[model samples]
Target: MLAFAAGFIVRPFGSLVFGRLGDMSGRKHTFLITIVLMGLPTFIVGLLPSYATIGMAAPIALIALRLLQGLAVGGEYGGAVTYVAEYSTPSNRGFNTSWIQTTGTGGLLLSLFVILGVRTLTGEEQFASWGWRIPFLFSIALLGVSMWIRLKLKESPEFEKMKVQGTRSKSPLRDTFGNRRNAMTVLLSLLGCTAGLGVVAYTSQFYVQFFLLQTLKVDGRIANEVLAIALVLGLPFYVFFGWLSDRIGRKPVILTGCLLAAVTYFPIYKSIAHYANPQLEHAHTMAPVTVYAPPGECSLQFNPVGTASFTRSCDSAKAALARNAVPYSTVAQPPGTVASIHIGEQVISAVDGKGLSRSQFAAQTAAFDAQVAHALASSGYPATAVPADVNRPMLVLLITILIVYLTMVYSPAAAWLVELFPPQIRYTATSLPYNIGNGWFGGFLPATAFAMVAATGDIYYGLWYPVVVASCTFVIGLVFLPETRFAAAAKISSARASTN
Candidate 1:
């Protein structure tokens, strides 16, 4: 958990540092630096030892790499998008920068494909132990290729023009912040534009990937296959929407996507649950379970690292059931009393203790976990989702629709954001809000939603996070966000031209 949080926690700081560099220096130079920075750490992450092998040092090393990756990515997007947007005339800004958006989706698909291919070659059993590193190691070649491509690129014409005209920002930070208008626009961009898009984009991709593996217990192979197919099918829509925005408007397309995600998330996820894990859905209704404990005794079900043991019965019982994806309501029992799990008509008593040795505790917890797993399996709950029973075509369709929502919010985002700020402070002004939205708001979706699901024992409850965020963005964007394609850039250009 701390490691994951570390990845996001450093992004805003990275944006601050690299955004300054991008704005002051050439966009090509700064992003060239960022790409190298990002690629090296990613390559090293593949080589890092696991926790079991190196203890605390392993996680620490991984955390450091993640932070580095965060920093690189934080600065990388702004420069990349700004470079593309500046190269594009107003007529093609949305369409051209939409290709940048495709890289994100395409990169994810590429990585997934490479992983599956590697796993297939290495065989499934060996892949987990040693083969996982191949993809990360392969990033070195990609890094070399990326460096080559970046080397050939020229500084953006717009930025170059501004520099030659003696209109470059002396201090991008001060210029962006000293003025109330830019600050207010940046703030609104966060609340309305990036925040909503972040939630929608991440929830569709990362959260759905998580739901398939962890919640549905679907085989990783099938999930990846399905996702890759959906991505390929839905991938063109990113460019289509971006091109569409040029004709219609950025706000309408983006906001419509947000509203669509907000309204349909519940049913979409519910359908996914039904088609992907039909047995779990049926068993949940047929043999429901409830856990009883003292009101405040149950610990929150969020321990990403396995070091902490939720030894208390209230915590242990819920953890066991939650791991197996068994939905259970918590019942309040007498304070300080031992916990109990009521499965349909059967009641299972939990072992209680005020103090116990570590060995004794582990043994007790292991036994308790086994007991709960047995009870759930016996009550017709699946141990892991069976692939043969799934409605594969329907699952693909649902995930494809989710990807469509992703494209709606993400496709035109770069062009829209680029249009929000001027050539002088564009990199710094836009990067902060964009990174904050994705890094902080979107990055934690899986952990946050999983916690919500664990706490409530309702898998669908987690959808509320994205749904609420997207809905808020819809309303906020409608009111505060400006139409950036035609008027926004002119306004920013005039404002900056006057100031500089």
Candidate 2:
């Protein structure tokens, strides 16, 4: 936890530093540096020793590595967005900027796939102890690949034009924040776009996992697997939505998504509820069977019961019987029932047939088992031999809705943010607000939401945090955010006309 907090704390500073460097020097250079920095720490995290080996020092090292990661990420997004936006024509800005957005989803999906592959190969027990570390260590190779791509990327035309014109800001920070107008623009832009993007993005991904584990009581492995599948399925939508914004305009696309999210939030949650609950309306229509034991001591036994034993004492018989999924009519047993069942310390009593023949009772038990199986299959619960609760499927469905909203809003934001400022201060100006909104607001989502739930004692209340924030940003976007689809194109056309 300390590591996570420390990393977040350093992110804004990293953004400030890298943003300035990108604006002053070049976006491509800044991007390569941040990628290398981010990847190396991730690799080191995989190699770190556990508490048992190094005691308190282990956690300390982990925290330091997290801080490094935070710093690197803080700068990475801003540079990548600016680099892409600068090269793109204004008419296709949304579509081009979306490539940067898509990278984030791609990165997450890649991580999920790696984790899933490792788990499948190593199995659960071995994976927990050491197999989990392989993915993080493997990122060193990814970093090298990114570095190669970044090296090949050209400098932005806008920045080049600014340099030739001798119009680059002497002090980018002063120009960015020293002027009240620019500062207000930055703030309004973030409030209008990035804030909501941050919430939606985190809610869709991180909060879903928490909801599955804590609220819906889903098996962690199953929940993760479902989420991984959903994310991969939805990956194309990120770029598709980004392209749509180019045709329809950024504000409309974003506003439509936000409005749809607002209208559908409750309904989506309800759908999940219906799907997850076996007793709910859409649950599999299975006939229920009731099993009853006769008015005597009854023992429940499993087939292929290895080394199974029951005790002579009444309490022991009840305790042993309760562990099995036997449906008995009453809680109490008849007198002398306990003493009659002890055979070599293993109890064997006359299995009851409550108002039914032996064969009829057996049929009822089979029906109950079939119902349980149907419920488990419909719920997508883990296929363990033991019966488990079926609530996570609903939570997973809710997460899918959230992811849709997230991708819709976030995919276009890179273009919107990049277009808001001139090339001279674009890197620095965009990075500061983007990191704070995403790294600070979005990244802290799980921690903040969990803390709120812990304090309030209601899981649903934490959702209000994202809902309220997103709504406010949606309103701001409707009122304040401009359509930037044509801004760069207009500028280029004007430049060409002047030259002609």
Candidate 3:
């Protein structure tokens, strides 16, 4: 929570500094620097020691890293978008700028893959303890690669043309905000475009995670896996829809995403809720079971007085018990496996996976009926259980639609925003609005939406926040946003001609 909040707090400042620098110097250089900065901090985070070892310093270091990350990211988007937009032809500005937006989805997908690969390799316990850091550490390699690519790219043609003509604004901030017309244009552009993009981005990506885990009670692992898959599947649509906007016009694509989101939010949430119910029921019915014995054998040890005994090989299970906040023993077993199982606890059970008939299994189990019954009851599995009715496909479909809406709204803004101001103040002007909308509205979405559900006892109410915000944005776009698909170069050209 603290890390996420830090990202929001620091983003606007990053935008200001980087945005100004990008406008003053060159977009390529500024973007490359921000990318390197972002990657290095994330890499450092992967290497940092845990709280158990570092004590109070762990959280402090974590916060510091997150702050750096926020700053780096705040600058990165504006720089990248400006670079793309300045280089792109006005006719294809939306399509070209959309690549900047696609990179964000790519980053998310990359993070997801790293997390999943590490988890799959290490298993849950190990992943929690040490494996979680690998992905962050891996960012060093990614940064190096990204830097290489960025270095090879040229400065934007538009900014170069302005520089050649000596037409760049001396004071970008003053010119941008000092003029009422430009200031209002910036305000209206943010209200119309980025605001909606921010909400859709968070609602689709972040909120879906919350809705699945908190509201529907889906397992975190499953929810993340599902989301990762959906994100990958939906990624191409970001560029595709962006390109479509170039042909059809930006307003239609963005408004379409907003309208679709508004219409689908409730149904998507309901579908997730409905699917997750059965999974939760199944989890309750067929609870997990663990068994413990001596190091090499399944032999049980009894105390001399037959009241308590010590077991040495059960260290793993004991560790598991400790992790779950359950109390257990390295020393003591009450007669059977029944006492071994506890609520919110794990018990080690010895079972052969070899094939056996149902009746044969039942008859065989009768031999240890008391112990088996105790284990079953303790593990929370009833003798008679109903089958679960989980609709995984339906859930996947809904999440896909949600990601599509997010990408549609977000992908076009990168170019659209950069075009709103002159090259000189483009960074500062665009960055402020982008960060506020993305940082405050987008960042707080999950928490705020959850709070709404908590207060109202209805999950769908939270959807209203994004829906209403995007709806207003749709209206704003229709009223205030100009067709900037061909304006950036034109502005520079006009400035140059005036000077000449």
Candidate 4:
């Protein structure tokens, strides 16, 4: 968990470090180094021993590897966006920069496919044991390809021009912050524009997947397949909107996404609820499963990876139903007794937590969860919405709409951010806000939403997080963010005019 958190906490710092290198050394070489740093640690993570195997050293090593990834990603994006934007003209900058957005989705699709294939070949049991390592180890091949491609690339014209005239800032960091105008511009963009974009984009992809498997209670494999296909169907829109932005302006396309999400998320997810568990919905109308457990015995269901455990029998059983995204009301009982889960005429006794060691308790809870899942599935509660029962056509359309919103926000974001800062300190200025919004605002969604749902006992309530953030962006972005479609060209022209 500390390792995962490092990915968020260290990104702003990484942005500062790598941003300075790009400004001083040049984008191509600096980002090349970042790719190496990222890829090497990714490959090494596969080889790291687990906590069970190496005790304290295992977690420490994992945290270090994750930090390396965070650092590499932090520095890498600024260089990339700057490189692409520098080469683009005012007329088609959005269209060209859209490829960056497209490539990210493509990369996600590729990585997921690879992991799925490996899991399929290894079988779920074996995959859980050791097969997960293959995907991480596979990063080395991609790292090699990335290095070769980047090596063949030449430097951006903008950076070359700056170096030729001896106009590059000796202290890019100082210049970026000391110029209050530029500093404030980046800050506003982060909070008002990119922060919202971060949430929308992450929610569209990652949170959607979470809802399907964790909330809608879809089979993990089935959920993944559905997402992969949807991603494929929607991949082209990233570039499409990029072209559209070139014609209409970035502000409208981006804001429209936020607006669409803010207004329509409840419905989109409501539709998912209907498709994923029509039976549960029907049963829910007739009778909701009510859990009766002792106070503090039934812990709220919030399972962050590598953090928090539900140990008591009541907590474990309650968590099981919640993990499957079942809506249940709790009735408090006395302390230390087993939970009784009531479903219509049937009552299932929860596992007893007494007289068991820690490992034994964990094993007992795992069995208890499986039993509850089975009982629920047997009693007209779908573990996953049956393929035939699902509203496939609407599901596809909803998924596509969600992905479209993602493209709307993300397609022009890089170019807009690049345009926000002057070339000399562009790398430094752009990296900080971009990474912070993505790393913190976007990355924090799952855990935050988990808490929200747990507290309210409504599966859909967690969506308020994104809805609120996107709305804030929609209003602020409209009012404060300048039309940066031609910002780069304007800056370049001003530089040339001064020289003349």
Best by TM-score: 1
TM-score-sorted candidate list, best first: 1, 4, 2, 3
Candidate 1 backbone clash number: 0
CA deviation > 4 Å runs, candidate 2 = 277-398
How far in Å is the alpha carbon of 337 misplaced in model 4?
12
- How far is 255's C-alpha from truth in model 4 (Å)? 1.1
Q: Report the C-alpha displacement of residue 290, candidate 1, in angstroms.
A: 0.9
Question: What TM-score would you give candidate 2 relative to the actual structure?
Answer: 0.75
lDDT of 4 by residue, 125-174 (tens): 99999999999998899999999999999999989999999999899888
Per-residue C-alpha lDDT of model 1 across residues 411-482, encoded as one tens digit per residue:
888888888888899999989999999887888777677778877778788889999999999999999988
* Clashes per candidate (backbone, < 3 Å): 0, 0, 6, 0
Model 4 spans with C-alpha error above 4 angstroms? 50-53, 290-305, 309-320, 329-379, 487-500
Better model by lDDT: candidate 1 vs candidate 4: 1
Q: List the pairs of residues colliding in candidate 4.
A: none
Query: Sorted on lDDT, highest at the top, how do the candidates line up?
Result: 1, 4, 3, 2
lDDT accuracy of residue 424 in candidate 1 = 92
For each candidate in turn, the TM-score is 0.94, 0.75, 0.75, 0.88
Per-residue lDDT over 1-500 for candidate 2, one digit per residue giving the tens place of the 0 to 100 score: 56666776788889888888888887777888898888998999999999999999998888788888888888988888887877777677788887778777687778778888999999999999999999988888888888888788888787787879988887888899988978887998778877777877777777766665555544567777778777776777788888988887777777667666666665665455344433422221232112222234434322121234322233232332222211112334456543212212222333233466657656644554354434444443323322144555455556666777877988888888887887788888888877777877777777666544433323444577677778888898888877777765677799999999
Least well predicted 10-residue stretch by lDDT in candidate 3: 297-306
